[model samples]
Target: MRIAIIPARGGSKRIPRKNIKDFCGKPIIAYPIEAALNSGVVDKVIVSTDDEEIASIARQYGAETPFVRSSRLADDYTGTVAVIRDAILQLQQIGWTLTECACIYATTPLLNSERIAEAYQLLFDSHADFIFTCARFSFPIQRALLKTDQGGVIPFDPPSVPKRSQDLPPTFHDAGQLYWAAVETWMDPAKHIYSADSRMLLLPERLVQDIDTQEDWEHAELLYKVMQSLGQ
Candidate 1:
């Protein structure tokens, strides 16, 4: 069995009610729910949230709200692993067997079924502990700079100041979309998603955005609109 668990707690301090907020005419969380259901990989999609409104909206979007997350797990300090593990355990107790799991974030409005399927394929074929999406940095990070208290700039990596951008190594960042892992690996808190044993599915930087503030939300909406126009 395979499942997709989306952690959408109600206490969104940055963009208030961000998970269910409108994005391109629909609730932001609806994107991931629809993507997971359309992926053809997950047997079930579950929305693990602590808020009644979020749970109600999740069901309306076609995901199951089998459980309302505990206040302890819904707090800001609770980590993703803990939330996923708790959901898996709850499912097991209720007699739902799971072989694989995907943690799909509610903020990923640009998520598509193709990427989710690709990650699942890679996880199955390579037999890795975990897989997730990432985006390469548009600029080489080696020749970075830092602003001083006096507004003066200094080379973050002084040694790479003279090196050409093409000669520098490429770096990437978490796209903040989804993560695929075996149920066993997810159950083990010691198994981390960022370990060397895990793999990453690279996405174009334009298609990746993290909605943590009003500016970010506006930027993501703009990107989403442009992509829709381009028939992406």
Candidate 2:
């Protein structure tokens, strides 16, 4: 069965209660929950969180909270993979064997139902182990610089001849918005949300903001407003 698991822990140091914080007049976690529910790709939408408020909000938004996340996995140092693993285990104990799962992020307000469905379809059609959103780098990363011993800048790619930004090949970076993968691949210790054979689904920079800090949250809000105005 297809499932969507959203990991939201309570101990956010960067932005307190970040998962449930207000975003565009709605709880931040609500966006992903709503998207997953409306996506039509998954049979179940679950939110794995340790915070009572977050769980309650998730439930209110039609997401299942089969169990509260463990304290160990709720800590700041805990990785999201662990949380997803725990959630999958919990669901299994309750007689649900998920065939595939999407580890969606609660902070990604720009995630829409259509995008979620498109990513799932891509995974299915391409026989991919996993798929995640990414945005292209506007600037040439080949021309990146590093600090020298004398505080001078040096080209990171010294082997490549110095070229103008317009002449460099394009590069991309993980948007960190969300990820989808086969359950078996994602649960393996060696693999992760993005598997070895994972595919990168290109997304526009405006829709790929990952809200990890106050600055990021503000920037996302601005982008959201602009997108709304443009009827995107």
Candidate 3:
């Protein structure tokens, strides 16, 4: 079975209740939930959250809240791997043995149903055990530098010559939007990205935004409104 797990915790230190914060009218978490449900690829959309309010909102949006996330997994320092593992375990206890699963973040309002479906399709077509969305760096990262304590600039890669932006190979950074992985890979703690056989789905910068702070939240809201107007 193909499932989509959205990990939303109540204790958000950066933006305080960011999961349920209003974004373009609905709660922030609702976007991912709705996208997963609308995505024809996902057989089940499950939300792993500790907040009662978030749980209620998730169900309202037609996502399943099979169980409240444990306090241990809800801690600020807890990693996403733990949250996902817990959710899968809960589902297993209830007789749901997933074959494939997607980890959709609550903060990524830029994600759409089409992208979700496309990512799954790519995974299936490539016979990849895992796939994640990423955004390319507009500028050449080879030219990046660091400042020293002596007030001197240092090249991050001193051995490499700086190439023109157009000449440099395209590079991508994890968009932190979603991850699609097989259940066997997810069950293995040492294999987070579904082993070494993982693929990346490239997304445009405009469609990839991580909302962690108030400024980021505002920026995402603005981008979302603009995209809606453009009929994206």
lDDT score of model 3? 0.87
Residue 196, model 2, lDDT: 64
Q: Highest TM-score among the candidates is held by which one?
A: 1
Per-residue C-alpha lDDT of model 3 across residues 63-116, encoded as one tens digit per residue: 999898988888868888778888999999999978999999998889999999
Ranking by lDDT: 1, 3, 2
- Which candidate leads the pack in lDDT? 1
Which ranking of candidates, highest TM-score first? 1, 3, 2
lDDT of each: 0.93, 0.87, 0.87
The residue pairs that clash in candidate 2, if any, are: none
Instruction: Output candidate 1 Cα RMSD.
Output: 1.2
Off by over 4 Å in 1: none
Please report, as a residue range, the 10-residue window in candidate 3 with the lowest summed lDDT: 159-168
Every model's TM-score: 0.96, 0.93, 0.95
Pairs of residues at least 3 apart in sequence or in different chains that clash in candidate 1? none
List CA RMSD, all candidates: 1.2, 1.7, 1.5
Alpha carbon lDDT of residue 146, candidate 2?
A: 93
Q: lDDT: which is higher, 1 or 3?
A: 1
